[model samples]
Target: MALTRQVISTLQDNGTDIMGPDVMAYHYPDASIISGSLLTVEANHFAVLKSRGAVLGVYDTGQYPIQTPDKPLLGGFVTGFFGGNSPWQYEVLYVNRAKLLVRASGVATSAEMAEMVYQVDYYIHVDSKDDALKLTTHMPFSGHYIKADEVASYAAPVVEQAINQVVQVTPMEKINEHIHEVVELLKEHMSAFLSVFGITLNDAKVLILPKDDRMRELISLRAFGLSELDAVRYYTALKMAERGLVSAPNMAVGAPFSIGGATMGTYPVPDGHASVTLPKG
Candidate 1:
């Protein structure tokens, strides 16, 4: 969502007050648009403002009336999106009448004008959060057309679902002990498996395996007996090998060993240990 604070700030900075329709014809007779007819007048103006890299404000000014030379003139800010590639501009023209008038202008075609009117109506009457989000991200213009209730209603369920999905198990000694046991079991299995293939384990706990070995066959075999935790660790080592983080006979010096499988696969073990896959039937 665009920050409300920035929207308000932008409005305050650029908002303007103009005389209503009655006064505009006399004051600026050359002006092409009239204020009171709801045909081509702007009733109010709003601007979206940004501050400190975040949207901070949306400022709105009071509506005013528009009248002819004989009638009293009313004044208010004009609200709408202006100066874009689109032929139609969205605006509300302030008039002497009590009711607000939303109008679209910029084209002589009736269909185009009708489309603009529809747009204005949609903006003023619709309560769509998705539309609001889209406008905030794409539109350069700004106003307070969005309602607070719409946003709250749309976001509440999503937030609740996220909170509900969070796992909250208590960390305990049993959990740690189980993890250690799985690590040790994996280590033993890997050592024995590597021995059959002439691979060896170093003091650092790295399993040195031949490049030509059937790594995938070995991995599939070991994966069968591994607890969830050990499987995670073994998968992680395999990933490291694929990324060239582990050493192998065929790889360039200091390059990681190459293996095959999902990148994020993990074995059920703590950090700082390695395992090698054994052949399967």
Candidate 2:
């Protein structure tokens, strides 16, 4: 003879969009849901029912009655019940389908061997049922909710790796000048990398900066009447001379620098004797 069982008549999410921008997934408190229970899923959300790590079904923005005919998993009954509860056991996880902003920062080495700090602001979202399943399956969250910072934490290393790849081939002096190009490449690489986790990269903004203040000052010379080419040539010569790659006499005022077999014209240095006048700061 079959014993009596307790049934949860209704399962609903009252705190729908209230999850806000920080939350990614919300875990339903009850895992013992029986057939014929009404599951209310809010808009812009996915209600995923799972049994022992297996996804039984994904419901979007509607009320669903947990019936055995529709879901075969609901047919199996868990026996040896102490309390008058149904043998069926399942967990429902609500995934937020909204686009979320995630920010990540890291340090990368430039082609010039300069340590550059980088930050990326990106937008991501889980669009389909498959995306929601992958997210719930792969990214396990503790407690009741998974937050955006958790996603940011996972993205930080990936973003850094992508930034390193871009900057490692780009010289420090020209990094800022080609920042848009860098951002595009980062978006491309990061999009592919994040796709594995069921997240889509909508857009991203990347900012790269030299780790040293002196390097920043050197690159800023372009704002003070110096051309981009002249700024690179000037900073290159200074770095080379500092490293003893160029002789002291070759660094004198009006002395040209021969870099990569090409002659670069003189750069005026502030040593109490220079022809070009610079704006006083």
Candidate 3:
């Protein structure tokens, strides 16, 4: 889509800030202007074009010298033609364009402005259905009236599919590579510790003196019969501590651990207890 320099200058003169550098203006029919921000003169020309399905392309000198051409002129030269200004002022330009009917208007309310901006931004920013879904899921009430349940039902599957596709593809192997590096480092450190302490570094017996003392505490908790999943949770807690990720109170020594539902405390185990109860799935 193209915009004439005349149109750009007029918009600027009328206090309409040129939003993006690429907006170019051109002559379009009345129907097209109905969905666009229109100038009064352009609207009249558009009306004439719509009614007659044709209009004479006057020479830049304001002379109606040529017959209405059969084919639309996609590009052409025009000098300062006298409709409202100098005839030699013709400069052709292209604009980012889309058509949207005015939904509501009256000395613009915030809601109306938001709706207009949303329509334009959605058309420009959303490249695919998944992107649209992400936008809708994250901000469900942007422009139109949509029920919450309906929005969620419609959006969730698309977002889930996009996420699954991203995860399953495994395009970047950096995390896996990093995990391997950490394991190798742990192994080398363990071997050295074993040599110094005169202990065999068997896989099962490896002390796994985690990279830090917090990790050692988590490992100790896990070794004392915490479930593997719970061990991971404790490990995450330890990692957060090591990274200063949170500011929660420190866990007191020998205090009970409480998560979503499970609790671990320093209760005495009966002597001769031969079995442990596991959580029901």
Instruction: Identify the candidate with maximal TM-score.
Output: 2
**Number of backbone collisions per candidate:** 44, 2, 13
lDDT against the true structure, each candidate: 0.28, 0.73, 0.29
The digit string of per-residue lDDT tens for model 3 on 163-236 reads 22322333222223243333344344444432331222233111112234554455566666887566666665
Which whole-number lDDT from 0 to 100 does residue 270 have in model 2? Answer: 67
Model 1: which ten-residue window has the lowest total lDDT?
114-123
The TM-score of predicted model 2 comes to 0.68
Tell me how candidate 3 scores on lDDT: 0.29
Tell me how far the alpha carbon of residue 194 in candidate 2 is from the true structure, in angstroms, after superposition: 1.7
TM-score-best of 2 and 3: 2
Which scores greater on TM-score, model 1 or model 2?
A: 2
Error in Å for residue 179 of model 2: 1.8
Model 2 over residues 1-281: C-alpha lDDT tens digits? 23323332223357335567888888877765666677777777887888777778988888787764323332224233324445456788888888998888888998978899888889999898898888888898879888888988877777777677668988887777778777877888888877887888899988888888777866787667787666666675576677886543454343655656666554477695653422322
Question: Candidate 1 versus the native: TM-score?
Answer: 0.21
Which number leads on lDDT? 2
Worst 10 residues of 2 by lDDT: 1-10
